[model samples]
Target: MNFAEKYLSIRKHTEQLCGPLQTEDYVVQPVADVSPPKWHLGHTTWFFETFILKPFSSNYQIYNEDYNFVFNSYYETVGNRVIRTDRGNLSRPSVSDIYQYRSYVDEAMVKFLSNEIKDDVNELLVLGFNHEQQHQELLLTDIKYILGNNPLFPVYSEFKSEILNLPSAAQKLLNIQAGVYEIGFNGDGFCFDNELNRHKVYLNDFAISSSLVSNHDFIEFIADGGYSNFNFWHAEGWDWVKSNHIKAPMYWHKIDGKWFNYTLQGLKPVNDEHSVTHISYYEAYAYASWKGMRLPTEFEWEIAAKHFNWGERWEWTESAYLPYPGFSKAPGAIGEYNGKFMVNQKVLRGASIATPEAHSRITYRNFFHPHLRWQYTGIRLAK
Candidate 1:
């Protein structure tokens, strides 16, 4: 598809994902890491206005003067904006109002794209779509969090996940003949700045599991007092576990010795065959340690990814989220996109089921705090 067509298609998918939510569902943010569904809707629209319309569109009037202040997230180069924690408390910009704002911005964006745009503008437009797609994954996870944490446990939708029946014996570690391998995006397609600057790194031979760690495997760790044991955890992770009294993955609970967890279809029995998800990096690390293994580094993971199936969950890696060699950030607000987040966070490789179509690449680097498990995160073992 052409850039304009792809842009419109992506935008429409975001709206469609929100179809099951009630008016009330769009405004609440259950946690600080997650933005409100309404906020995501507006903030993505604001991206086009702040980056594209205001700069490129001829005489483009601001949709709502106050929106820039409310929706501008972490763009210090733009102007002072709302703090991250304050996003959930916003109520004046009702869900309906946010939808109107999205419509206005979408109209302007379509008109701007109608002309023969320059290559630079085309690049920005693609980035905007990718940005929105990233938020699309967040919207789903945030929605799941909001409902999963609620006392009522309301069902988000009637969607049932397609079950994958992999033979239990198929789960084995593949010995990787690691050597000097090139990693990073090199094609003409759009990629985040963080995935650029292709380079080579030598890796000692190692082995990675052929499939993701299943819930049954994680349940073994849990049954063996995984949370109670500190030896399997990092210092900060151990503290996080004790202080929070975390016994299992987020959304998991044991009732009368039967394990249950929340899914998009609402509360359901934990599926043993499914890959365990909603696990924090700490949990993933501890689980790997318990097996006398470790999570693969980002480079190791990338080199071995072609040999195993991924894209079910964002697999945690041992690598820190740092820039590549010869990496440089662009000037201005756009530069702040991924460069500023390259510290003190762990990198995750692969994509989750929540990721939008065509949104993930082998070089894509997903990062989050080691303690947060709100996303679809899982563990992959390496030794």
Candidate 2:
């Protein structure tokens, strides 16, 4: 597909994901981390209008002057925006209004793409495509969070079973030889700025698991008193466990004697064969420690990714989220994408089931605070 076609397709897919939701479902934000569905719809549209149409399309008319205040996320250079936690508090600019905003901006984007685009404009357009794709993944997971938290355990759709039944591979470890290995994005295709400055790093010999940690594997940890044992956890992790009373991974519920998980299809029995997901970095580390193994560093994951199956869940790595050598921020608001959140976050090295197609690569770096587990996060062992 050409530029305009790809743009339209991605935009349409975002809307399609919301097809199963009720109007009330679009406004609920159960937690501070999860944005309401309506906010995602409007914020993504605001991205295109703010970055591309306003700056490039001289003849384009602004949809609503106040939208920037309502939808702007964290771009300090883009002026004021609705505070993150208060997004759900606003009942104005209803869901229908956001859809209309998306339609209006999409029409403008299509018209702008019809002309021969300058190289810089084309670059920004690609970034806009990726920004929306990132939100698309967040949109699905956020929707899951909103519904999963409901006391009724509402089913979002009938598509949950298939995601849990990913093709399983024989569990084993692939050994890698110690040497200086090159890492980071080397391709000419689109990649986020954080993947730049491809460089070499010397690594000692190590072995990484070929398969992700399964639900059965984590259940064993729980049965062995993984959460109750302080030796298996970091000081902060153990503190987190006690403070939150976290026993199993998020969304896991223990009925009379059986374990069930909340999926998009609502609550269902925990499937032993499925990969364990929605785990925080702390839990991943504690589980690895309990097994006498460790999580692989991001560099180790990239070097060995080719030998194993990934993309099932966002595998937590041992590396912290930091810029690569020679990494620098771009000028203006666009530069605010990845550089600001470098500290106090763990890097996750693979894509999740909710990630959009063509949006992930071996070098793509995903980061989250150690305590956050709302995303499809899992664990892999290394030694």
Provide the TM-score for each candidate, comma-separated: 0.97, 0.99
Task: Return the lDDT, model 2, position 280.
Answer: 96
Q: Residue by residue across 1-383, what tens digits does model 1's lDDT show?
A: 87668778988999998999998888888779988999999999999899989998898999999999999999999999999899989997998899898888888888888888888888888889999999999999999998898988899887746233434448889998858999999898889999989999999999999989989999999999999999999999999999999999999989889889998888889989789999999999999999999999999999999888788899999999999999999999999999999999999999988998889889999999899899999999999
lDDT of 2 by residue, 286-345 (tens): 999999999999999999999988888999999999999999999999899999999999
Candidates' C-alpha lDDT: 0.91, 0.94
The residue pairs in collision within model 1 are none
Residue 372, candidate 2: C-alpha displacement in angstroms: 0.6
Best model number under TM-score: 2
Clashing pairs in 2: none
The global Cα lDDT (0 to 1) of model 2 is 0.94
Top model number, lDDT: 2
